[model samples]
Target chain A: MTSPTPAILPERGLADRLTALFWRHPRLLLAVLLTPPLLWLGVVYLGSLFALLLQSFYSIDEFSGVVKEEFTLKTYAELFRAQNLDIIIRTLVMSAAVTIGCALIAFPIAYYAARFARGKWKAVFYLGVMLPLWSSYLVKVYAWKLILAKEGIITWAAEGVGLSMILNAILAIPGIGGNSLSTSPLGTFIVFVYVWLPYMILPMQAALERVPTSMLEASADLGASRAQTFRTVILPLAMPGVIAGSIFTFSLTMGDYIIPQIVGTSARFIGLAVYQLQGTAGNIPLAAAFAVVPIVIMLIYLTIAKRKGAFDAL
Target chain B: MTAAVEFLRVSRHFGPASAPVKAVDGVDLTIAEGSFFAMLGPSGSGKTTCLRLISGFEKPTSGTIRIFGQDVGDIPPNRRNVNTVFQDYALFPHMNVRDNVGYGLMVKGVDRRTRDARAEEMLALVKLEGYGDRKPAQLSGGQRQRVALARALVNEPKVLLLDEPLGALDLKLREAMQDELKALQSRLGITFVFVTHDQGEALSMADSLAVFNEGRIAQIGTPAEVYARPRTRFVADFVGSSNVLPPEVTRAFGGPMKWASLRPEMLRVTAADGVALAGTVTGIRYLGAGSRLSVALNGTEVAALLPAGQPVPEPGATVGLAFDPAALHVMEGEG
Candidate 1:
């Protein structure tokens, strides 16, 4: 019925009382605010990574098609072989090309949407750019396959328009052949660039949107030409977005196996290699080792991008 | 002096023919060289649009704009010898104060040494000498504004366009910056085209002012001329506080009018025996320097400002007021 007795303790100062208060409401303190990310990093991301690293240490026997229990770096050692290294290098080059291509195309589109387009058209144009992103990525790549095939709509239309001879001649030149675009690595690269273009565009649009139109006006007012405004003010302000979008395009292209498997005849990417080693050969250790190549490349990319303030664009 | 900037029959419209919004409708104005000019209006009254046209942020739908005697119809904004301090300042957040102020020079291919020295000089002029290394975000509002001014001024354009540059600051800071801007404009001897919706801002800083209404120039004059003799009801009501009276002119002295406007301070509160109208005090507001009393005179509300030490009329007390005839402006109602 009466109030509970107050706890008696040694006399303490304001600092000690403040610490005690913090301890009492620890949920209102630090840990509650930090728990979500801590759990994600500790349990999901790092745990899965630890498991993958452990698997990479096991050796795969060629004839038996079984993983050895004993710890070994043989799988990783095998990854440095000429064939595997070629796949790794090809992936890097293709990813870089796609990222650069996307950046080039996206910059103008984003600039137009941010600065020139007015009222409802701005939203409509941006939505058109983003609509492909919501659709299935696989479907979009598959659609490109049909368009690039030998008897595809594009080739038929080119022939119907009497430009097929010119197109065929260009395609027949040494490195580029008369064979269908679907049968070449260039086909895979084109599809990769097309499918992931929106990823680059949306972020660039967001970044360009953050740039005040006044800044561009200010640039022009200072006697800089339209070209100069783009180069100086617009380009510098949109750099963060460019880098951010590049990261997405580069990493996504590096790790994608589906487009290459469907559209390419001879091109072999690290992602396709990983899929082959795991799915067909039943060599989990080797596949895991191949996964490390993309992970390492992405880590290097992230470090460079972070240093350039790309994350601030988020 | 030659006109530093001039707009001849300039008109700008947006959207399709079925529904076009005329942002600037046939405005003809001439800004004198080395003078600070202000375009004042309420929002959507085309003040900012007019500034944009002069600054080359926008081109006229039809007509010509001349800067320092050059007809700049085909010349793009960048090629124009004008710079603008945008309403939001638009300082590059990624660049430090030095780089931001130096950007215009850098784009012109100036050497780093020359650009940096000039940028530092401008930074000092704006009283931001030590702040050259700080980013725009790191500086306070007033500091950012100064940096924006320095950036615009470093280009040494013949005309400087400011779009409500002091609108973002708090009251005290705004007043200080207003004076600073006026003094800066005078010292540089460069023509300034400033746009603001605040009447006080226009009256204080402008050497001459243009009042815009519905995308048209309503009137243009020096501050005192505009304040003393507004040509329209809108001008009289907008430029300052005035007691607009709706009166049937049973007797007329100069012009035809159904209403007249009188400045509150021009009305002398008097005893009931010697005044034209009888009124009862409705309310009183005590300002530090002066007190204002609201009176109901002939079924219309009239406000009069009195000295602070004057005796306050009670709310129900009967009172009389008289206004100087010279200070009264007769105006026609909106047709």
Candidate 2:
């Protein structure tokens, strides 16, 4: 059989010609494919980050309340002042608490979903984790606010169950407590944990899924009892996912102004401080400096986590 | 003396109760102390499941499992005193080779120094003395396999279970590891229960082996005995290439009217004259060491293994096959 020559071959369509051209110059096709997302990342995301960083370097004039465009460490030095330092510390503590809380609560749920949930149960688990996320964030926060209020179902239930004294005792604690549950740091914390839990659960579930059943079997077969196997094998293997989940919870809690503003004490968080300073107070440099705190904290956190081999599993 | 491991009519089922998959069914087995025992079968033949039952990973539905004469009912895998070298060599990827090897000791609350020393010693035993610092991911497949072995052995369990430990290796590496494994088992004097699908691996490494079919043990005996005289068609067909003859063929060869097994190597193909059985040569396959000649006889096909340097017969030619009368093994039941 004689093969058809190019002269007698059918003409190629535009799509075919483009495919042939792409097949010959693969790098050109890659560049074409990557251009849109690369531009979005480089210009919009990183460009804004660089602008914020540059803004943080400039200082606000004390008397004129005007931002000086020149680079100076004066605005950064202002961050060391007692009142501003209080907001930073408070935000840091809350972020850590929320992250730890999310982790503790998410682990068992994620473990159950990863190791046991199958077919219909798996779908139900995913729905349970993601159901709250489908609601608007502000709506969820406000709903939590109502749930934690003085006349809310929790307080009523506690009273009905003869546990109101315990509830009152918890609310009577100094810095976290307020006149009502809606006006307490604990309420803010509860809302924050509730908001960020799904983020924690999904990553943790994915990490736990990657842990082979054979690994657990091997560990048990080696004479490591259930608790020992959990400590040495399961926990260490799940650390990366925990760390990944913590990144979301920690950073989100740090930057959230709305939750604290609506629920907590009159004292402010870093996000609220940044909001007030940049808007009403017109201290853009200080606001930018406040925003940089979570970034710097996360950098240190990631470094420590990496050293502990958290990303190794990831 | 009590067997190292014993199963009394164990059965394990999976999925729904209405029509469950019987992974293992009514299996009774015993492994002698300090013996290298292999469970030989194809995939899903229940050999691996039986190994898991011994290791306490899977519980038997209807029977007791005794390890070292102790009924291990409801005892978890960790307390069973048997360790498994998983098929995929499930060495902890997060830990270094030393830590992985010493995990059992560490979990037992042995001090760091003792764990380190014992781990290093086990690594040396596996001929991987200097590779302790590397992660499992850092090592080659065979190295990881050795680490898994060291990890399991460091526990010093009464019985060691290997689930196709050499299945992942290449032919050369697998053969070398098989010899090393046999040597190690004898030297340690620990009971070794190995599982494999490869008949050659089972025949070579095991002191005694069981042939599993479906979910039951078809036969169990020493390599030589099983190879020379398989009691069933499945054993003869699976263990090695054998010419299974029907009852009519057995009768034609002046044997009792029963199913029979004839080893391929026992038959000699010649010109179709004055022979016990005559057939047309259907196929000739070169096997480097010898040739396999398939002959159609008595309404069924039989193969003859021709040694190297023999004159090969062409297909479509009628050939006579000769074998000693005693070589035809009469099986008890129909396949």
> Which candidate number would show the highest TM-score if scored against the true structure?
2
Cα displacement (angstroms), candidate 2, residue A289, comes to: 0.7
CA RMSD of all predictions: 6.3, 2.0
Positional deviation of residue B255's Cα in model 2 after best superposition, in angstroms: 1.5
Q: How big is the positional error of residue B3 in model 1, measured in Å on the Cα after superposition?
A: 1.1
CAPRI accuracy category, model 2: high
> Fraction of true contacts kept, per model?
0.79, 0.92
Off by over 4 Å in 1: A1-41, A61-73, A116-123, A130-140, A173-178, A308-314, B247-259, B331-335
DockQ (Cα-based) per candidate? 0.54, 0.82
- Runs off by more than 4 Å, candidate 2: A1-12
* Candidate 2 clash pair list: none
lDDT of 1 by residue, B1-335 (tens): 89998999999998896887999999999999999999999999998998888877777999899988999988877778788998899887767889899989988999999999999999999998888888888888899999999999998989999998998999999999999999998999999999999999999999999999999988899999888877677887888877766554312323345567677788778888866666899998998898898988767788889887778788889988876678777664341
